[model samples]
Target: GSDGSPQWGTSAEDRDPPGGDRSNHTACPKQRTVHKCELLHVAIVCAGHNASRDVVTLVKSILFHRKNPLHFHFITDSVAHQILQTLFQSWMVPSVHVSFYNADDLKPEVSWIPNKHYSGIYGLMKLTLTKALPSNLSKVIVLDTDITFATDIAELWAVFGKFSEKQVIGLVENQSDWYLGNLWKNHKPWPALGRGFNTGVILLLLDRLRHLGWEQMWRLTAERELMNMLSTSLADQDIFNAVIKQDPSLVYRLPCFWNVQLSDHTRSEQCYTELSDLKVIHWNSPKKLRVKNKHVEFFRNLYLTFLEYDGNLLRRELFGCVRLTVTLPPTLQQALEELDEDDPCYDFRQQHLMQHRIHLFFLQYEFLALPNPTDVTLVAQLSMDRLQMLEAICKHWAGPISLALYMSDAEAQQFLRYAQASEVLSARRNVAYHIVYKEGQFYPINLLRNVALANTQTPYVFLTDIDFLPMYGLYDYLRNSIQQLELPQRKAALIVPAFETLHYRLTFPKSKAELLSMLDMGSLYTFRYHVWPKGHAPTDYAKWRTATVPYRVAWQPDFEPYVVVRRDCPKYDQRFVGFGWNKVSHIMELDAQEYELLVLPNAFMIHMPHAPSFDISKFRLSAGYRGCLQTLREEFHQDLSRRYGAAALKYLTAERSL
Candidate 1:
């Protein structure tokens, strides 16, 4: 076989090309087995032992959901044949008949074919189906192993009737723009070929394919460098497209829901909603098959359930219903337990955010349940480098604690891994980590804050950052302050000044009294009293809240740290990106809305010392972000002009009531 000689293969009498045949349906021979009564005939080409389980699971999914009789034909290697034989016998599902052919038999005929532009050996195997399958089968559905039928095989079979006389194949068009655009660029003559079809699902008329001798067309593409010139790894797909361009009427386009590609999230405009009538879901991307995100995890777990299906009572129950409830294997169970809860909020928020078509992508973290019922959810955004800071904050903040940790896309997985390993943090399931922005992109502080706030379920939320460590008893003080403000009908914000350590020695102060020793005696700053009230705006650092007790003042847009507000309060304006004027802009918005900003006399946090230059210039905002900030500045000025008539800009400084 390896010597490149022609092998024995089937040949049909009808010798017309594909589109020229309209009356060859009855030319196919009749079947010799009882499977001829089945209404659905599905064929799959699996390569080796690696895809053996995938093929078995796909077959199980089809058999589990179909009410009509079905027959399956598999073209695979010897190892897979052994695996499927054992799998079918163990499942005890006998209404179906599976006929397997050794794919090696076709190799002698295609052995001389070079794999220069070959995607995979499986692609080579697909081209042999016309000769390997029974001549009696007139129509069949070919599917990729890495897919599941969400609906019924009968529905997919119904698409065959919709195919016109000249349409020999029914398929779903590839909704991806990248592939279509590249195809257009390379093959400029066929700009009107339309979006090419994905070969994942196909309704084929085997008789027509054989009558037209279409296998030669596929072989010709490989021999003539038609696909090689295009530099496409999709060997079979390229050949199919080459033929489709010659005869556009040879394909019947099906709805995209029939072959929903999961990683095509970027092509959301072409994707179907969850509520749509989906018949098949193709896990086309190999990256997702490795289990990187929740969407992949969702499909992976379902695939596992299908693989281990034993036709037991639970399997029978799942056969009637699409859902299943079964205990996971011990090793997989432990692995998943180390992750966060499978929160549906990730899916819901993804759909919500993508509607805006913002460049931002959502990351999924496993969620831990709230440690204990508390009135507030403490939230912050940080990277993996700040684990020590987070641990220290968690040790000092003593209250019913629930946290939402937001990180960029690059470090979210690493930080989550660390959190899962930490005994002190993972001891309770309360923190939710969100990947709110792309890896290494300009950190959209306002957008992260809004995501954290929207996900917070508590009545009050304490918004702060990672580097700031709360002083002892700060949480208790805030909890008490919130109770006192409950009776007031007006919205309020509890503000606390943040102090930074002069050096690393003072960074880990042994006690609250030791840290408090640095605060000035007469409400004035000293060398040790490093009260940095700077939050993207100039602050009167010499002044202090000398009321000697908690008191309310007219709100000012200056403080950014240790602010506790009701959950119903307006959220931060997300348009302001980078470092300058973010939290202060929110404060100004609240001031204009007449919400009181309360100053707590004794409450403060010790900011951890880091590298030099913790200023606005340190964060170089991208050009896009600078543009966004400019737009916000204009909006703020326009609002001011509307309120105070041109001189309102001067009143920005005059309005500080504290």
Candidate 2:
């Protein structure tokens, strides 16, 4: 029931139909319950020429794609309002939602002080913060529209929703906990800001906001931070984090992938397949994303020309093969059915909202909002008989621990030749391993695990390889060993014991599916380079393995996988041509996850197959190297010639002075 309303809840029996529901407050008609929802809502903050181009491309992206039906709302500067509005409506669409006004229209200005203050926002994209949020958010999907939504908005709203216990207010509750660990100011860093958050994409929870006096919160934060600092790294993002973190009751947190963008570490596309339930794709200034190389354009071109990809994988990527079906609410259900019969937006406000509200209830509060927090179903198929073989992967198993899963296959007869060389390390272990095949790929089962990890459920996982030998009582000894270091977060789980002269990372407690995915994606890159350089393992690894029995789990964890600030995800500069050396991204993810690379004095793990077959005799990292250089150059244009030239050079040659 709506507390401030004229009674909103009904005690009817579930109102939900068998596999679908028609009684939703905003349900559509039946003829077509499935249609692309591409209506666009944009907040244009800057009006300079380049900003204009960005908006133009943004507008065309929405306009040119006829398959995606859309509506546009342009929030422009007061001075240029007239010209912008004309250009905005010039583009054809099913509808044009134009609100050409000054940033002053956002917050009420009772006097002259307010009007002059409006000019302040114009200084640096303040319209994004000054604009009045929608009072009626019934049909709005706030978008930068700078991105191409190869998928639909309706698909997102259909599968996802907010936490509706208190009437889900917003669809996205950002994961900004990671970077907030340390705060930065005027080139100086603060130890903490509680948690860092990105306010890129928001699924407005209007009615709830109105009821809870939500506008007051945004207004306050803006006045305090946006109006004060005017120079925070997160910008509007910082103000948003202040509002939500302080008021838990006002908003519900959505899952990790809902508004996926760049973390200081992760990229949206790289983790796209992993974030299974992603709905709205916030192409957050994608034109500016720091990718591999100038070749990052190659990826952009590939995405735009997705339909033109070559071969099977390219074709699958461009014209995605994702099968989708969504059940709409009664009003939308009705509107959809009558579209052929010509239904107008005459009663859109009242009827459309009623239906939208009901369906929104299911999407936000139930399944889609979060990843399967506790495993539900795997992507692969299995008979009911095989289901029992799959374990629940208990939550406790996910606690602070690192695990490493790797797979490898030698030409059947080749194993016989290496047996003699593999005898140095003696401990044996058993864990699940899946075999994947490709013509000439070095299938180190664990290489994929090394790459795809985003944020682990548990802090610690292993970094040991398949051909590696483990010291006896390794787990018991790790307990006493880690108790000695002062890692950033005492909760950190880095157990890279230097035993038997080999060192490996204790990465995290992950899912079997995750390990499988790591394998799947790893094969895509691992065959290009060596997983581990042959002679890198320490010769004194055995003695260290014997020395760790008396240590305790030490060190602090700087990154918290449980509550991440989405911006911390590692991003790949696409210009990176190839060692495909970019595979090192996996280590970066762990670093972002708060694991440190500990050079051991005496610890080690056994690597039965310690050679990287991928770094072939004719290895030419130049193309891949140049690709990386170009990506950095493009992403940080000025930095390429100044700040990052040296770093970029080193990245390309895998040497400091390259």
Candidate 3:
């Protein structure tokens, strides 16, 4: 039926045999039944964890036994409990992956303190071979997940007869010095079978791994300090070497074509051209293809291409609970049951809440956490809140908010200089104070009001950018205005001092639609972040850049939102932590159906300007960058690459209009 080959396609279903259900993402092949998948199933055990998840997933799906290609699994102790198991029942996990096993379960024959680490891992590897390996498996190859097959594994199996029948095996020779031992004759070897080998690519025989002295040899060797296991006493591999050298009849030294060891990959991001000629590609420490943001982004896109239920599953994992089932050994199960359900947790809720929110966007600053409220400073929100009526219309958008403070650090000499240079703010009688500094804040409207409720003692403290200028002197005008009201009784957070700006960004056309758009009639600001193009003022790098930000006038609510505080008020809730300040916006959540906005008439202000430069491509919505990816999308779950480096996008949505 087919005229071409799907050389690059990795879908297990596409390759599954005839009469098998190929409808589901899971392919059930009726052909190739002679091999039975359960037999060809291979598991790779790794002591290192830089790469495993996604790579293994692709290999498993592609090489999975439709008629039984092989069900490949990777074992490691590094997986976190909440990562894959907690998110989905779909079974396939994200990242370079393999089936998991904890090295902590391996027990030592002699009673010495057993670690849950490297030494413990050898025991687990032995246990896996002793317990699960199928009896009929001609030779079970335990390889590193970094392995990429140059050719189909059938070729590797074809050569099995080349070596005498055996269960455990490894690549025979090494061209490099073993990190564990020196190969030169100057070094003495007591039990080592021969020179040490690179542990990266191993072809394991379950029976040979379960040989008479394997566990004993590993235990005696691992008992001493790990450093002592050099040439004189090799760890797991050393034991294998000793055993193999004594009995080459049990193990065969395969040629370089079988297991190729790579020297360095850090210099480049890729190297498969030379590798294409290999049968089983073994990645020793896979640095280039390790799982990270790219891996997450790949899976994120797959949801749209492959699964119809993508978003639903994401929401469920984020907001709901997942069920997990594990088959533990009888003794292990009993030990876990003895402990109370909550005994291991000191305060699970608190830790979970904090850890979960760390990934949310609004958590990277101190202002968002409301660290201090008593450090009294004027709080001003540079946002659109004109008439009280318009202010009420803009309260519905739930977006992020950011806060910043402007503190003028002036010396006693500068205070004297400022009095003559700018008369807008001057020394008051009996206010004998040397200029330590004058301070202020720019908060989102929600936080501005919150800070005001706590800072009532500062009689003259109010919200206004330095742009708040008036003929009567900006500070005097505000101080006089606050004195006229009963501060405690009315409790107005801030006396409104919104000023009109003199500068804005002129819009240029990138496209016809946005180019024709104009600033609304009588509205202020076209571009944002611009400094006073004409002022020689106190300059901070932060202050200097505040000018020249792009701004546009659009439909926004306006309300008389001012700064108010009682000096003892708590810090503001910092849910908003980036930009955008909508006035009287926080109060709308309360029932401020209609509150009149008091405008400072005939006044003007210019927001500090900063130029805009952005590159949107940096935030690609790939699997590794999107929301969490624990399991593969069931729809495209079948399309895993042999190397599983990239997700293949399968669906394209045409423009609804075009």
Candidate 4:
């Protein structure tokens, strides 16, 4: 190839076999001992709504072609983290390990760099990799979410052997003339060496970059460029190009076919002569797949192939008996036994949280097909003890239910056996079970709720607890009401009146009229009517007794009614764990977001009496637990005010005055 760069594409005979050793040609002394079986470290920055889907496709493409083990480091927001955690946990791919780092934690490092790109601050997260990742990691390959691979990634990893001592990064030349200032009149791009480099696929020598003080270098380059330009239009790419323009020897130019850019204005014809020669497809345009390229269909179909690939085939069991497990070291096990039993806050202490990892969707069972698609799904959470209630709930609801079950590693194994033997629980095709496990005493109540809510596929969801039994025909009633009430267009939450009974063995009510009779006879009462009147007072049971149509209810403090809301409503705040203020904080956010709460005329849910949760028992017995709950409540209100503004806090003030 010209310019001393490797050829864009090579025949099978010219390249090493898949996972073949190439340490003899290595240039960096630190990577000389690298073996073919070593885990390939890959970093990605994913945030926002659709990023998870794209990232899944990207990962699928890599898994399809790669032969070695993989370790993925995701820098993501809370939403993407939950979604991805649910997916990769259930995926159960052999030799794959995933780790998530909060994107908010890395924002401050690159927040000051103003970006004009559509991704905004998220596009600049790559700059923080040298500091965000652990110091022990020596090298990594960073990829953009909008990419698909057609060849084994080991070939790209092998490129590290070609890097000179002075070269700390490997990248392909930009396929467009955007950096040449030729796309439009008066165009001024950040400095570059000739055509500049595309960052979509990069080989990062982390140890080398750290030794060279990569952070300070890029910051200085960005500061110098900002003096002339208003802001960077390409985020990290612009700053990286400026730095490389100053020091040309710091980068090793990779084959252009590795990044065949499909942007609207891409000039990739000079990179590869045919679509078959391209190794990686990069849909860099905002209108991905729809971009104006002659070879768009070829790349689009490749991406679709991975997107729709059956993930079941990738499970570890398909190959052998390689099940995932969570085992603590002997030293950590001994340390946990020495914890003080008298400490009231021991369960939620920093030591416990630090030692345990919360595994989301540790085990999952999803229905591949259903006779009739459901309009509304019941989203609920429970522990292993409540697993028996699922059969009754599924029998009565007669619709889809997305359940998040919290359990230990042993309980998860027990659940699998229990589901197989129970006909109603296992044969019902509309129920999806997502199992979560964490080695801690306190329950992550809101975390479970958010996981269930995020995984729901229906247009609307009925948010409730596993202990509550819905009134018969509630699913059909809501399906009909959703059309007549125009619920699809309105920003509303249809409240379902709830009641509680102390008798463990009593006939469940079949209609609202039966429930009203039970209320009058004192066999049933509004849930927590006397103990916590403020909780359900906003529903106005007096008006609901004879009302035939939905009625609007004013927002009030401590109101937490089970309601059927659109699936895309605000997520529950995860900070409110261990029972107190969890559901109320979510209701308050719905109120703050201006969602109208309309009491449904027919729907009803009855809370069956059961043993109180561990968190509830602790709250009642421990003063320390109550104090922590109070502190969290105050912090939640303050955060709500900052998010939705002062006008949103007026509801709290109005409720207090009353």
**TM-scores, one per candidate:** 0.43, 0.35, 0.36, 0.52
Q: For model 1, how does the per-residue alpha-carbon lDDT over 367-479 read when each residue is reduced to its tens digit?
A: 33542223676767654456677677778874434333434323443565676688776664445444442422335566667766766666777877777777777777777
Q: Write the per-residue lDDT of candidate 4 for residues 7-41, one digit (tens) a residue.
A: 33222344454577567655622222223355789
Pairs of colliding residues, candidate 4:
none
Query: What lDDT does model 1 reach?
Result: 0.58
**Which ranking of candidates, highest lDDT first?**
4, 1, 2, 3
lDDT, model 4, position 405: 83
Report the backbone clash tally of model 4. Answer: 0
Candidate 2 per-residue C-alpha lDDT over 167-259 given as tens digits, one digit per residue, 9 for 90 to 100: 433435444333444334544211223433345555554455566565566566556654544444444454455666566555545544656
Root-mean-square deviation of candidate 1: 22.6
List candidate 1 segments past 4 Å from native.
1-374, 398-410, 439-441, 505-513, 520-547, 554-561, 612-631, 640-658
User: Could you say which candidate leads in TM-score?
Assistant: 4
Question: Between candidates 2 and 3, which one is better according to TM-score?
Answer: 3
Whole-model lDDT per candidate: 0.58, 0.34, 0.33, 0.80
On the 0 to 100 scale, the lDDT of residue 365 in model 3 is 16
What stretches of model 4 exceed 4 Å from their correct place? 1-34, 316-658
Please list the Cα RMSD from the true structure of every candidate, rounded to 1 decimal place.
Answer: 22.6, 25.3, 21.9, 16.9
Number of the top-ranking candidate, with lDDT as the measure: 4
